[model samples]
Target: MAAEAKQTCYEGSSVQSFRFFLEHSGEHQAILQRVHDILPGEFKRIGAGKSSLDFLGVGSGGGELDVQMLTLLQSIFPAVPITADTVEGSSQLTDNFKALVAKTTNLQKIPFCWHIMKCEDYEKQVKAKGDMKKFDFIHMIQMIYYVDNLSTTIKFYHSLLKNNGRLMIINEAANGGWDILWKTYKKELCVDAITEYRSSGEILACLKSQGLKYEEHVIPNTFDITECFNPSSQTGQRLLNFMTATDNFYQSFTPEIRAGILDLLRNKCSTEKDGRVLFNSNLSCILVYA
Candidate 1:
């Protein structure tokens, strides 16, 4: 009998695996640092002539990046008060965000409205309110893969932007390791329940199809995957689970499939240097102007 396929990593409790991935992967740090450098110039184009600013964060896990963005906005428009709306599905992550906000004295000028629900539900709530609330800046980072309808969701968020507003999206680059993995093993690994993988290439195509104007920026990143080769390593197993979007991926699949995946991950998706396997996990940032 075949083994039963498990749920996607994000479908259940995913904070630990996600945290482990973030800690081990250089992707997040690279993206964050690049954003910090570029966002000030970008902020100048948004919220112009407005007395206040509104920011929205979709799938705002832990809120570390969100807070940094808010701080940057505050610096650029120091006198303009900011209102931030955070949408997150995980209670633990939401609590972490709230705790961070409570302790951060610098965020005093930005008032937060927390919505402990999925982005889909949050959209419904906003629409049901019968008030068209526009925002100055909205960011959806590393979280678009889970949305039910990518195009519709993108359009909905874009519609919520004020004139001269900016909608920023960051996703895995088309040439990145995640994209390569999904392209090769999607049939074998991806399940029907999840929108398993999406890349900036697809997003760019979607925007082009809709006649939307946008700017693209690529940030190169890498993560050490040498631990993933060790079968007994707990961290390795967790990384494998996140990479495959499967629970216990090291043990769940047949030995042949597991071996093949490991081989591909080592040889095809990563490079070897100094006895370490570094995975190419590049990211792309797309800025859509409204």
Candidate 2:
């Protein structure tokens, strides 16, 4: 009998692996830079004439990007109060976000409400409580793959938008490494509770299907995965674990499966340059207006 592969989501080590992935990959830096460039223009038109603004951060990991967006929003509307709500499934991440808020001097004036739960659970709670809070800005970054139903989740969030409000989503591009990874190994790697392995392409299609208008921007990024080829490297092992979304992937799966994944990641999903394996981590940002 074949042993079942364990999911990283259930392991405490997944957090460290995720942090390592973010540190090694250029995805975060590229998105941060893009956000800085785009938000000034985007915020200019949002919440005009409003005395206050409500911002929602769905699956906001650690709140670094959320804080950056909030800072930009505050700058655009200095006199207006902004209430920030964050939904994160990880307790450790929520605590890290709260700790960041405590240290940030500018965020002291802003009111923050933290929901330590998954987006589905949060939605269920909202329905159960009949919560009718509309948000001026809602941002979901690199987190859509965890959703149970893509279209339903999008429609649910879109319904929470106020007039002229915007919902921003950042996810991997269809032609990127993630798409290849998921498409190739979904049956072998993506099992148990994890199912949705979507990208920006699906998001755009969903928006169009619902007759919603949206603007899309591609953000080119890469992950230096040279270490992942090194079997003895702990960092490389962690990176592989994160990339595969499995805890100790090399140890969990059969050697044949491991070799196949490595080959695909090295040859198909990444390009080698100067002895470095750079995985295509290109992302897409979709902006949908209410």
- Top TM-score prediction, candidate number: 2
TM-score between model 2 and native: 0.94
Specify the highest-lDDT model's number: 2
The C-alpha lDDT values of all candidates are: 0.82, 0.83
lDDT of 2 by residue, 138-209 (tens): 999988877889999999999999999999999999878889988898897667545757878889999999
lDDT string, candidate 1, 160-222, tens digits: 999899999998899788888887887876674354568898899999998999999998898
What clash count does candidate 2 reach? 0
Residue pairs with colliding backbones in model 2 are none
Give per-residue lDDT, candidate 1, residue 186: 79
- Per-candidate TM equals 0.93, 0.94
> lDDT for model 2, on a 0 to 1 scale?
0.83
Model 1 residue runs over 4 Å out of place are 1-13
